[model samples]
Target chain A: MLGDCRDWHDVSVIEVQELTKTFGTVRAVDGVSFTARPGEVTGFLGPNGAGKTTTLRMMLGLVAPTSGRALINGRRYVDLERPVVEVGAALEATGFNPGRSARDHLRVACTAAGLPTRRADEALETTGLKEAADRRVLGFSLGMRQRLALAEAILGEPRVLILDEPANGLDPAGIRWLRDFLRHLADIGCTVLVSSHVLAEVEQVADHVVIVARGRVLRDAPLAELVRGGELKVGTRQPEQLRRALEEAGATVRFEDDRLWVSGVDAEQVGRAALDAGAVLTELVEERSGLEHVFLELTRAEMGEAG
Target chain B: MIRLIQAELLKIRSTRMWLGMLGLSVGFALMGLVFYIALAGVEMDGREALPPVTDPDTVRAFYANASGGVLFMMILGIVGITGEYRHGTITQAFLVTPRRGRVLAAKLVSYFLFGLAFGLVTVLATVAVALPALAIRGGSTSLLDNDVPMILGGTVLAMGLYALVGLGLGALIRNQIAAILVAIGWVQLVEAIVTVALPQVGQWLPAGAVRAITRTTGGFGGMGELDTLPPWGGTLVLVGYGLVFAVIAMVTAVRRDIG
Candidate 1:
């Protein structure tokens, strides 16, 4: 995507340059590059083994990169004088002692950043964990734990937040709450980079998307741009007949299973063509491309090209 | 660095395991007193006991022998560090601090302080409980009168070093069982055999160095075969061992990818 060369007018919260991580002979994170900016939630989309976690870890300086660099707020994470104040991350919800109280856990994080201890209680309140604040984390449900982790991340009021699978264990209500919460954080001009396997959730929350597969970035663009790149699907019952008509009418046509897939023509045009050709239109549904379909297509296309 | 240390201390205080370990430390200390009382009784009767101890040095040696109960302290140390890895809490810690070395330093400091405190409390409790019985048998003696600072300092040093070792093992292996196995095996088996088979070389091993520094050496009985090093030399070696392992652990942790 040449993300590095493209000058993003907005403030860039995170920037990666040819980020590569090789574990022995395995290239866990290949030459992947992307930038996430403030006032927007950037979705780091990747399937399992796609190196999303590795990239995030590298960004946080938890894992060193074999090549390239990850810069946060125009400086390397390790170089930051106050890291917690600069960047707050929740890489995994399991990153807490189960026997410790949620309040104590967050208080420790606050102390690490030199923040006031009262921020721990405030974070718990923000994450709706005030009732369970004093309770041991061992008894928390997955959703509660996720919230607690989020609470810890925001305790510092950091300029940037990096979370991996933040919605993994949330219920529908919890997911909605998180979506709104992240959007509000971005609204207040905080940069948020969230990695998730759930395409739907990402689509719901992210303004920008970075799709990755097999240690490579397949696409890095605005959500609208990605959705607009794919051809829209228009369905009709006149299979063979419609294929011939579409080609005659200057539309690209392909056959899949028992249906005719038409491109290069609007859904209305196709319907008009079928009507003009005396074909009974049993079905005429215009399918807008979704992030899921775009993601699958890009990943599958990358796999096919690689193979 | 101070902030990280404070945070780690808070985590330690909030854990049930810490409270449990405190309880265990008290229990072991009381047990040490009971054993000391029994030994005093045998000494009063002038009966030829196992190993035949009758002097105050021997009595101090006997009480020193009971310090082996500090294994509970070791367990506490293991849980203190390894628990984070097991529960995946270390990621949050790293995310907050990012400076892996600083995070480790905080853990080492916090764990050492906790171990020191526990060791002091236990030693005082044991002396308090066992004094009456020792007095009846004419064996009671104050710690201050009998190199108490040396003894207490040695005990605290041993406990603190073991705790640091626990933290290192936790970071190196990351698995609770593996860390515990390595810790127990390092103290009970590997170090023991090496100290016996290679007395000169054994002086450098952590546990051996701890014994040497502590000065009261009848606990292992025949296993205390190696001539002890000077107390300062032993302390230096123990501290050096802790730094080496702690540095390795921190470096490895910061470099490795989290799951």
Candidate 2:
């Protein structure tokens, strides 16, 4: 099974093509389309109610598409010969019976997927829930339940993982562990599509990002491209003068928060432009437009358009 | 499909709810047996007097009525499916078996077995109570030597069929509280009223079919008057109801979105 992980990309791609889902009068997912490739962590970024869960559900065939379809491995999820062995998913953290033990929970999934029951113990060990395996979920904290869900997801040792808001109840340490765990899965060539409303949770681990808001894909690109586009900030006593110099240097400059927002230029150019402008510089730094900034800009723009 | 059924059975086994329900089912069976034995030969209003245990029909009725505890089995089946929706485990179930029909079929099969088990246990419990009480009351123990075994088998089969019906109802009505209320209400209140008011119609209902299996003539809920179909006809009608409900449940389960 481990050896089979290497070449999964040939057949394990999660392809959503013009997928749309409408609930009554509400278009919950509006022609959303994206592919989560194997051997990479695809961060499904969205705010709450952004149709992230709905799209994932459609891909897993838990929800029917109103007009379009989502295919896994060039076949619909329902058409998969062995769905669990090929695609493992944790759609939510709370799909567990309160009275069931964590181990029993995974075992049930394992049994359903035709996997050995011992895989339940293996999954528990992988998710750091081994010690609490015998404990009923009724007494488990939210973090524990989240871990149990992950354990259930990995029961089949699937090559593809789709998790929806998997870090909802984790503490900081648990979140860090999850980050490393996902990275490890992707490193081992599993296609990981994890959705999170929190940008920072996905920022450290995701190789690619698919950002959605209001039932539409706002942006889908490499994480590095989404986060880094060379925007610089130059704070000076003469903001107008620095802005004019930076604009002359062929950079888009905006005056905001007592600073010159320079884009389309490097830090070195900004420093030189400021020096030539005869402006006394107070602060000069490359403004790293992290995922947080990009996400806000995209979602806020979406909100503006909607309004 | 077999794996899915095993998974469903494992789910029921993992929870304490089924064990508690099984205990309650046996208790109800014991209670009904005691009541039947105590009331033997006594006359009740609006009906024939309770026949003595020596009568073959009376003995068969005693064995069949013991499966009245099978009501808990029906509830078990309802909770089995509805609990998945209640806890959001239907998502997990569907994810594991993307062909939603397979999952529904698996649930129907597993719950059917559970219903059989419940019926079997209740019958055994009732027999344990009936044999001693009958011997003490000077009733012939030879009653078990007659069609008793056949009646017990039919009662167990009826219980399993009832479970399928319950599973179908639960799948159709995903809400646990609402489904349970419908099961109890239809079996207890509505069926009883119909059996009393319209015997012909009651004879075709699920409880009437079950009574026919046990060769019990009086209407469902042990009230009113009904002329039941023959045993084979009862089996066919119950199977028909189960299949109809199972099909409806399967189609709905496949079509509806998992919210």
Candidate 3:
């Protein structure tokens, strides 16, 4: 299964072109499309149950897409010769055998990918799991398992990395290390795609963010754009009045759940309008117009649209 | 393919399973030797070890019982593939290879080799332990003279086929516990019941075919009479069973989503 695949030719872009996966009557992933570019860390972010894992599974060819393709380097994941060397995917924490040692688990990956077994040792050391390298995974903590999974992913020294929730069970220090590690990989020209539901986690590490909701891409752009787009959340009994007042104040207002989502303006202006209108306030909080706001608002919009 | 098989072998090397299995084969062979030696002089009224002292049947039975150890080899193959799904390592395996067929093929090859080793170990251990007893009993322990080589060779062949059957079953049944239970249950209970109810059909079953191949009646003593196909015919039947398992397993593997 090796030696015949075409050389990738600087084409380490991960493209999910209209990927759709339906289970029974439900569409777990509905036409989700996003591209992860080379030499950058792309965050595939979405709220829980928004098809993040399903999309990752599809990208790795573990789950077949009902319609569409997830291509990396101009090829499906299964088409690549020595795919582990070219595209490393760690999609689940439940992938390793608990009875096997960390080194053994990584060695299996190394062997399967036709890489030298020494790569397992190298990966263990790189992931800071050298101390527990010989220990059975049945005794390892969640953090250790994640690290071991990471070690396996890098066992082949792949050019592209796709990790699903790599930071899900890490300590703060571990998470910080992972963020820096991904940054380092991207700096070295590896295409890195990391998925997480926590916007704050990906916010620090991702150069590009593909915010998804209900199996659809909501925002796909540079992280900088989402950072500057803050939302001034105004909660009041007279939501309609606040929505009109905020709009009249030249703010882009979206009325939802009896709350006024005033964008393109600060909370101070929205607060003043509520004050003058004599609308009783329940809550008025200024949320930074970052990934979190986009994630929440987009998910809420999806809920409303579905309703 | 060689690399894949190497990886599969490495997976077992890190665990205590291989050592445990090897020890079990030796233990079974030792037990068989002891059982034969102890029972050689037993009688309801203290009768002699008769049935003609040098008829070769006693030694043949003693060696053929070692084939009983190959059941572990079958379980080894079953656990080799099903253990991946049982422990959720198939996810990692599929990720590393991305070609389920290769993973399956690698397992078939690796487990077949392991099973053969198991058979060799058991038979050699039986011979090692039995030779001293035979010498003590004033009988010549000539392995080449009594069709011992043919019997042992046939046992090894059966071991490989059994492992293939185990691999195929494991593939067809992704649940390890369920597969193991079904494999054993079908042999011990289902087939036993069927054989009692329909003797001819039962003799054609895979277990019966294995018995035919090894020239041993299914029991602890390796002594009984039952209808069986010719040695080669039984082998073909067993091989057919293995192939059926492989075909079904590969088809299901391609269609089923990796959990």
How high is the lDDT of residue B196 in model 1?
72
lDDT of 1 by residue, A224-269 (tens): 8776534435456666676677778888877665556666777777
Candidate lDDT values, in order: 0.77, 0.83, 0.80
Clashes of 3: 1
| Model 1 lDDT per residue over B66-89, tens place | 356556667776787678778887
* The candidate that achieves the highest TM-score relative to the unseen native structure: 2
Can you write out model 3's per-residue Cα lDDT over B1-259, one digit (the tens) per residue?
8989988889989788778777876787678668767766456366544332254767676677677666666677778878888777888878778888888888877887887888887778888878887888766588886667767887787777778888878888877888889888887798777766765787789877776776666653334556667778778897888778767667777667764
TM-score of each: 0.87, 0.92, 0.87
Steric clashes per prediction:
3, 0, 1
Which segments of model 1 are wrong by more than 4 Å?
A1-9, A229-261, A265-282, B41-47, B50-54, B194-204, B219-226, B230-233, B243-259
Model 3 — interface RMS deviation?
A: 1.3
- Tell me which of candidates 1 and 3 scores higher on lDDT: 3
At residue B76, give the lDDT of candidate 2: 84
DockQ of all models, two decimals each: 0.69, 0.81, 0.69
Candidate 3 residues lying further than 4 Å off, grouped into runs, are: A1-12, A232-286, B45-53, B219-224
- Looking at candidate 1 chain A, the ten consecutive residues that score lowest on lDDT are A1-10
lDDT of 2 at A286: 72
Q: Could you give candidate 3's per-residue lDDT for residues A1-307 as a string of tens digits?
A: 1234643334547988999989998898999988887778999988888888898888888888999999987899888877888888777677777778888888887787778889989999999999998898989988988888888888888889999999988999999999999999988778899999887789998989998878888889989887776876777888877777777888898877777777877767877888877777788877754677677888899889988
